[model samples]
Target: MRVKMRSKHRKAVKFYSTCFGFREPYKVLIDGTFVHHLITQRLLPADEALRDLLSASRVLGS
Candidate 1:
C-alpha cells in the first residue's frame, strides 16, 4: 500500500478503502477500486457530500 501510494492523489484513493462505509459481508469487494468508480460516476449522492467532508477537514482539494 505504501509503495503504491506515494503521492497525494494516490493517498486520497487509499482513503476510500480505509474510510468507514456500508460494507456487505456476503458480497466481496476489491476495496478502493469499486468505491472510486462509483464516485467518479456520481452514482451516489454521498459522493459529493463526502468530498465536501474532506474539504472541510482540509484533507482533499475542493
Candidate 2:
C-alpha cells in the first residue's frame, strides 16, 4: 500500500517498481509490506525470463 524511499533515491526506486517486474497481479513485499501486484499469463520459464529481462534493461538502460 505504501512505498517509502529517500528523496535522493526516489526516481530510481520508482523505476524499480513500475518499469521492473513489480508492477499489477505479482505482488512483491518490502519488509513485509505490499508494494504492487505484477502479473503474468503463466508461471513458466518464459515468464521468469521476462522478469529477468526487465531487470537487465534497468541496469543496461535498454
Best candidate, TM-score: 1
Question: Each candidate's lDDT (Cα)?
Answer: 0.45, 0.39
Instruction: Name model 2 segments beyond 4 Å from true.
Output: 1-5, 23-62
After aligning candidate 2 to the native by TM-score, how far in Å is the CA of 10 from where it should be? 1.5
Q: Which lDDT value does model 1 have at 56? A: 30
Return the TM-score for each candidate structure: 0.26, 0.23
Per-residue alpha-carbon lDDT of candidate 2 for residues 1-62, written as tens digits (9 for 90 to 100): 12432333455546777777654333322331212223243434444433443332332112
How do the residues 1-62 of candidate 1 rate in per-residue lDDT, one tens digit apiece?
13433355445645654695522221222358757866796757643444442333322322
Total backbone collisions for each predicted model: 0, 5
Residue pairs clashing in model 1 are: none
